[model samples]
Target: MPVIVAASALLFSSASLAHQLKSSVTTVLFNKRTHNIELMHRFYLHDTEHAIEHIVGKQADMLNSKSDQLQFADYVAQHVAIKTPESESIKLKNVGFEVDGKFFWVYQEAPMPAEPLSGLQMSHGALQELWPTQVNMVNIEGQGKVRTVYFDQQNQWHTVTF
Candidate 1:
């Protein structure tokens, strides 16, 4: 009985020190009128700041430092890429990013192809470098279809058709 109690205490203490799960969600949507695909990426501020510090330096701070925030956004722009059905990469305009409460959002828009999509390819590789257990969730919504994909060490791009 004493041994069981001691083992349970050790298990609980070990679990308490384990790192929490890390995740982010990216949403892609197409606007018919504007002929552009809009992207919104949401990430928890705590994890994001931690990631920035991990990649750049320990002193880096996203919420307090303007350069840190821009650097983080630039990191997002570099990792994400969009390709049309014709296999041509679309130009992405990183409009801006914002920190609202506990989360941050990065906005981007890419001009849609002149021809209708036979298929779309989006490569979103965020946070995987910072943490091996990071999971990047991407959801594409537009037309009549909505699709979701998860990115880990083995996953990168999310490709689907309407």
Candidate 2:
């Protein structure tokens, strides 16, 4: 009877390790100014919806099952709009996901639209979107200086200046 109990303990331990090996990490970023919520789904090659379900509960299966061709960017944009925020416009900048050190969706926020034509004509000739097309050009809160290394399309990890 003791032998049988020991074997069961071993089996359970191995199963727990196996479960841990198949899980992934997801990072979500929410910007209050732009009212944007970005999600990054990171998974290993052998990992599946079942594994994701085990890690993040039952709701994981529904999200992990989404096809690669699905428009995640548009979906995120729409999802942000539906959730709504106190701010008028919040930009989703630098949405990225990493799987085994591989990065995906290195998107940067687009420039803000110009003011009305009448306003533009009255003021100094300055384009509303004059700042850089990249993310976090201004160093506010000191977080912008600490650059995050992300893998480019060429599979090379580059330190991008924000």
Candidate 3:
């Protein structure tokens, strides 16, 4: 009876929820004063650690290791991209990264549009290779409006107009 109970406990353990969902959320803000678009991406720390280990072959305890945090920032910068309304690519400058308990945050910035503020295209390609079910949600906040967009393997890019 004890053995049966132990087996059941192991089968339905909390460890099973390690990779239950692969998702991240990002918020983009247009800084009119700085003429830059600031980005903040929030992710589950556990999932991000696993992903870093898979990609870089090192478990990055983001809170403890500066190099690991930099690596994560680089990884995020590579996977995500921005484009102007005219289809020209915009360079995203990675500001930094931080660990807040169970969540990890990455900071980024890009040059604001030189012309009128019509629309912008953003592509979020993080974790798609490692996790097939990965979905990234991005929120754009500017001009007294907010919009949400989802990014998956199939739908990676979204053009948001304000």
Candidate 4:
């Protein structure tokens, strides 16, 4: 019917204008087998492409450009931090990054810090500089109960005791 066709057109138009979630998820997990702390970060591919263009001051081909992806991975590493209870930096080595489906992933790993992860300080500011509304959620696992922390424009750092 004419009414059904009009409704379908409206829905398709609205969907085209819908924005992405503007969020990223990072998970910090302790590997029991390797005794290492592994960090995995996932960001919406669309967001990353725009962000890279904004930072690079030119159009970026994130999907096909390996160097661009690696550059973004390095930028992410510089923006995040993890420190011990004693305020010692827990250096996380950049493992790698890759685009998988609709998501871009970055990986980092380091030897698990001395046990009893108490007063661990963490920060994630990957894309917040560009998008004020962006939210980065970090989930800590392999530490008894999974704890979650959210970082945004206002709250950049968090201390977690486990």
Q: For model 1, how does the per-residue alpha-carbon lDDT over 8-84 read when each residue is reduced to its tens digit?
A: 99998876654376888988888887888999999888887887887787777767787878888888899899897
User: Of the pair 1 and 3, which is ahead by lDDT?
Assistant: 3
Question: Rank by lDDT, descending?
Answer: 4, 3, 1, 2
Could you say which candidate leads in TM-score?
Answer: 4
Better of 2 and 3 by lDDT: 3
What are the per-residue Cα lDDT tens digits for candidate 2 across 28-126? Answer: 333446643343444343333333344345544323444431333333233221112222343444444222332223233323333311110001111
Per-prediction TM-score to the true structure, in the order listed: 0.84, 0.24, 0.85, 0.88
Task: For each candidate in turn, give its C-alpha RMSD to the true structure in angstroms.
Answer: 3.9, 16.3, 4.1, 2.4
Q: What is the lDDT of residue 93 in candidate 3?
A: 89
The TM-score measured for candidate 3 stands at 0.85
Tens digits of per-residue lDDT, candidate 4, 1-162, equal: 999999999998887755655889999998898899899999988988999888888788889999889888988999899998778899999999999998999999999866667657899998999989899999999877899999999998898888
Worst 10 residues of 1 by lDDT: 14-23
| Order of quality (TM-score) | 4, 3, 1, 2
